[model samples]
Target: MSGLTGAQAADLTPIRTPAAPQASFVDWSGGYLGIEGSAGASFGAFNFHETRVGARAVPDFKTGDATGRSDRSRSATTAVGGLFGGYNWQTGPWVYGVEADLYGANLKRPVASTAQGLGYEGVDPAFSVIRAKTDVYGTLRGRFGYAFERALVYASFGLAGANARILATEPDLATGAVSAARRDLSYLGFTLGAGVQFAVTEHIALGLDYRYVDLGTSSRFDLGTLPGPAGGPLSTQAGFTSHQMMARLSWHPGGLTLPPEVDETAPHDPDNGDTGRFSLHGQTTFIAQGVPGFRAPYTGPASLIGNQVQSTTTATAFLGLKLFEGTELYYNPEFSQGFGLSRTLGVAGFVNGEAQKAGAPYPKLRSNRYFVRQTFGLGGETEDVPDGPNQVATRRDIERITVIAGKFALGDYFDGNVYAHDPRVDFMNWGIWSSGAYDFPANLPGFTQGVLVEYNRAAFAVRAAYTQVPKEPSNDVLDPRVFRRAGTTVEFEERHVLPFLDQPGKLRIGFFSNVGNTANYRDVVGLTQAGVFDDINDAAAATRAARRKTGFYLNLEQAVTADLGVFARFSNNDGRTESLSFTDIDRSISGGVSLKGSAWDRPADTVGLGTSMNELSPSHRAFFANGGIGLLIGDGRLNYAPERALEAYYALSLSKTLTLSFNYQLVVNPAYNKDRGPANFLGTRIHADF
Candidate 1:
């Protein structure tokens, strides 16, 4: 009935056999890149050889005769970190490779002494001081190793190089004259090391190594004519040696096929391996500006006048954590010092947006930004988000809804321009960076507590926010009462793909309103006319009450090419009341262009040009005409004119992490007063980030 006989049934029965066990050993051959931290002691010797020739032909002093010499030795402990890249090949039990590495450290020592009676009649003594420092070093090495299972022991010998600095100070005791010289030198050296590396997994390995390096000697010489026997040549020599121990973690791209037991615990994505749930990042910027012209006829408590040099420095740390799925918390702590040009007064469109009106000789530390953001996905296409400061690498739906609450800058969510937003990286003018007349809500440092919600699709997005305003005009403290007195903004954005380069462009329209204690400009002017007070500020202070100010702005950014982009912003506010926050700008229009220097073979360089025009309303202009000062700019008597400014800058990228920029600005009718002037400002900035 089954259609099978006894012999056929026997043939149909299956025979089972155990599969052969998989190999236990891993193949350790491939190219790898890693970062390492090192610590150790550096020992070095400095030899100073000095030859003095006589200035006069006499019995006691002869010309071209050797006079003095000195030699010294010192040591210092140092810590360093850097990157390493190399390739390895393994055959049988032997492994060989070539590797290169670079490191930066602070290894310094000071050598100082006094030379007695070195001058003609023993009446003059000279003091000499030298500080020797080694800042950066590198190595190119060949490695030979023996492999046993998952571990390897290796020996390396390499050619080494280092950058050294010698700072010398020499002072004459008789005349109290001092001469200083700083020399940066590069030295060639050699290195020897031995290390052991063990594979934590097929793709990751941990290594510990010790190296001894010897940097050859460098010499400094000076020839000059002096008053007496010391008029000759002086020479100094320096040498360096160091012993360093380093720990390294490396990833081998070609050796990622791991056994099942190790694969379960290994990192899923090696490129972003360390980016788990928490991340930290930081940046520092220092800018110095000098204004040559624009001196006013008279000065007020807050006025820009005369020639001045001002500098500002800020350091910030960004800390972020993922609380749960689709939710993240971020905190930014910042420390800042220095003042803007003219204590951030005089010009309506201030030259430095990074600077604050409040001046402090010491650094002031504050919590700049603290916020929580949560995203709800609406099933759609996916997009890849890159890792950055306060951003984690992940995938997100193209259509989503996001809600953010807590303290942050309003500009972070609204009124963004591609070519001109961050003063730290792009345009440095307050008017150019944002919609000047919009006067979004904020305290002294340009941030506030708020709640923002955003909805995004493939080519369109809308955002709205309600934020706290300062307790009073230009105050550093917020009102804290959410509904009683507050500020609100709504923005609509459209993104398009341009036809020329398929590049994206964006247009945003925003409306804002603030309700708080403010004075009417027209009322202040009328009170001053009625003989109540000679000063408009006095009249304004006497009539302070709750009022509302509303404004609107339009922002546009378009990419013309792969290397060129342009941006424009226009804004206006009802000038019935005094400024609640930000600079004194009632109406403004600004536009700019940014070009990458790829056409000239300097791809990392950028050039920018921009212009801004700002105007005051009828009531605001009348108040200033009657000797009223509203925050930044007021001349005693007013010859009112629109404030106009043009700015240009070139930024050169010295390295991937460092940038140097030179900028210039020309301003006409500063503070909206014709009497003030056409001012010129020159500035330089150094920015570094990690």
Candidate 2:
């Protein structure tokens, strides 16, 4: 409660000029919605007692002794975040409220295994592992508080709930083969906490909060058949307690306040007083996809199962603030969960572009992008910029210089295609949405820190950027060595109008180079063939050294009519060294057509159809034939053929901000193996934006 006051000095600074300070009294009554993040530690104890079978008693697995009782305790530090909402009532200096929140937590112990150093040597051991975790928890609380000017002190008492689980994996007693068992319990208890908040603006407040929670002892849970000679059913009881400290930022829309002004006759244009200083936007996308059985002669480590269904969900908040004239800062915080089909393997041209390489068992919060953008006008015609995600409404010169720095996806700048750019709304195939052969540098989530500069004129634009790559292929961490291990890219774009049809079109050419610790496909293959290593992956690891990879791409988009557009991309890489990021593609070409449904009186709807072909280089194919696996695709042996995909989708717009799409894809020779299948996939996507 000790931060700066006044609406003008809040985190989101306004863009207007000259307003004397006013409003000394603050009001704290409203319904509020916000995000809260906490860090803390949890401590708990578990007691397990074996139950005898008809003729035998289970060995005390927790300990080597014969005693049936096993008691142990564990503590873990964790970080949790989620959404919170509540309403408060204020009378004089007293304020009371009731609040509820749910959070995904990483509170669990490491797996305890009994097979350490036994070197059963690649054979399945007749041993077991035990572990316990709490994945999700929430609370409903009643609060009481007192307000002093712009600050509030409060105390809360609540009921807390958690889903607690224990997992035990072991080998079968009779066959000495692997088996698994699990038990789950729901716990309910109480929580108590206190906190303070300082109102930074009439509708926004920043606060720090603390709470202590206790989930009382659980009833004995019975875990099914244990695996040893004395195997039997096992019962266990556990209790949980934790303390957390959280930072919160809440918006009281119900108590909205407007700045003092007297401009009823002002023009609503950028030169006048129309645009706001800050913009808030959000989007959520959920995709469900499935594949039926296909012809597969044999499966390898990265092979996609015959039949499977998977889903992924992502939600992001786009917050932008004007820092100074012609400059803005934007931050995008996202929550991602779920998995891709076959754990995102077995496909060079993956079916789902939205599927991330990293999967999470529960929703995880991450700051995916945060950056600053500055624009300098170069004395030319002005154009209107609409309000949207990461962009605020304003009028800027058509010819200008812009500089952007921070963390973001390179695709956001390069590979421009109006008909096949956004996967959530358009094409869903990676090869169609982007140039598959260009190994753009990125971490697992497809983002990197960099500086980008662009020069724009009425008919052309030139862009360049230098960005960080991952520490290793498909790694989640970015390398910090800048020039020693980074990526540099440059692109030139030309805008034109077709003479015959009088339709507009654009052509883009881009070149990229990356320097990193990489291995040559031919070198690694040679090492494996000489018997220096049994595995091609191990040979590649041993041969990794400073190497360079380069590529280029050509992209074009043309509007044929008022309601129809077409796009195409052709890209190729050197294919000498191993792929550092992106997928296993050396050369690719894709084309697509998009049509608006205005002919059927549904102008907001869209239909698209696209096709792509991806090929691997000769040496790259030989490496895979020797059982080398890249980031996404390898099937032990190669019957090599070009990976081809055909995709079609129809999006039905439910409203201005919501859409439902149905998609179908046919993949020929999945992962470029002629012996395998022409796989078919069906998918649905629900997308919302505001």
Candidate 3:
């Protein structure tokens, strides 16, 4: 698919070939694969009607009447991610192609509620809710474009289809109990869009595009009769239109087959000295987990259901740019989908580290981390730094001062252990991988804005940070108040030699203080017990004010031999207040051993075993005993005991940058409720980094 003539290749000399024409320098004539992320809004309307009325139906209720249907305007902001592939045929300045893409998306309309029922319905304010949602969609399109040197401007039109659903949750007026019903649909329509793409390298291109999709009105779906005497069969239909703006990155393998002489002169030559200034790397991880049937005396809103399977997937891209000496900027954008078993509830020491509080059926695109780092080097011994994600290769003095500001995860800098820190390649249990009681400040995706400063030396280091906390307990939104409501953390690190085994080891001690709009457990429980409120949770909600939580953690990692290591952690927090972030554990202690495959044969494989015991403070236990719920766990009434977890895993290396791990976890006294279960979890993880 050369865009140039045969005569042009023979006449070009090695030295002057670098000055070739734009068409030959960057080819747009081959099959390409791409990943795209989009964020925009969806607009729609849903119409609801009662097809049949029962004996106790109100006189004012009209079935299938022209003006009786509940017609509500619907709208929502949406986020989506997906993949595409296509082949392009380029003839000089003109190019033609056909492309198809499929996406998992979160496009949901707001809930429309019906007016309350009449007095004789025997229910207080009985209501019904209706909503429309789209989970997956795709487009099959043909493209036409004009090549402007390194950029291509294109337009496309095609057929579109969406997997949509209409959901309803209504109260049975006679019993005053709520139930739900849903109808799934496939909508076929049309799509059109235009975009511009620019070649960043011979094999890579970046683009931005906008599209408008129409999923025509859906057919009426009849939901059978409701549960109570005053209820009736229901039906609904909706029409949807969405506008999306997407960013894309693609790779073309055909560029790899270019003539060696020409390839060396391309912009992304491996021998270029300036290449180290910019770094781009990516990783994708998938984890599937399941639990078998277990014994349970009762189940609550947050109880883990037995005999269930679930999975989660995440894809992340890390991009870094060095602006000047000792200064760099980095961004990490990620797409995540799926949920944990029981929707990430039940277990106090959760089995999946990658699962977040917010779970979705479709992929959601988010910028999880963006930060700027500045380093000040002091004259001393120099050290070499190898290139990796978010880190550029360079040499720096052993003694230096580093400062970082912007948004990131607090775990990135604190309570880290070499043997158990990363869940993607190593352990998968939250209690084993992290200081479970630290309660670090974070949003739903486990990220927050902050500023950190560190002083490093050959043998020791000191670091501190000031960050934003959640606006309220267990909330995703961060508080803007820096001084009034914020988080501050400090850590001290010491690298030393163990006299017993003559091995190297590191020790870290961290302290954290967080101030936020949280309620006190004792206060809420007292209000609930005094007949002032019906539930402890509702009482706590009404009593929230400024409160402070403090905690500390100790982390240690030591090497026992060339192929073996051991790590441990101990963390605790004052549990008088409600949990602000993280799990429900108020005190935790964990330890583990990790062995490398060098012990046997495969040097890249590893095996690990860990155990943890998590406990809730007395007051925190009383809160749950009174039917209060924290972030991840609460089982209605208390059979209070320390939650215990045991985890083991074997990670088999498929390649230098890929691994498949098998994991197992045993959680006794889940959520610290002894009457519940000794649940067992089985999991598998596939991870890749490049």
What are the runs in model 1 whose C-alpha is more than 4 Å off? 1-275
Candidate 1, which ten residues in sequence have the lowest lDDT sum? 56-65
RMSD of 1: 15.0
Question: In candidate 1, which residue pairs get closer than 3 Å at backbone N, Cα or C atoms, i.e. clash?
Answer: none
lDDT score for candidate 3 against the true structure: 0.78
Per-candidate clashes, comma-separated = 0, 0, 0
Return the clash pairs for model 3, or none: none
On TM-score, who's better, 1 or 2? 2
- Estimate, for each residue in 356-419, the C-alpha lDDT of model 2 and write its tens digit: 8986534557899999999999986987777679987777899999999999999999987999
Assess each prediction's global lDDT (C-alpha) against the native: 0.76, 0.79, 0.78
TM-score, every prediction: 0.62, 0.71, 0.71
Model 1: per-residue Cα lDDT at residue 143: 95
Tens-digit per-residue lDDT, 421-537, candidate 1: 988877898888889898888888889998999999999999999999988888889997778889999999999998867988999999999997789998988888999887778
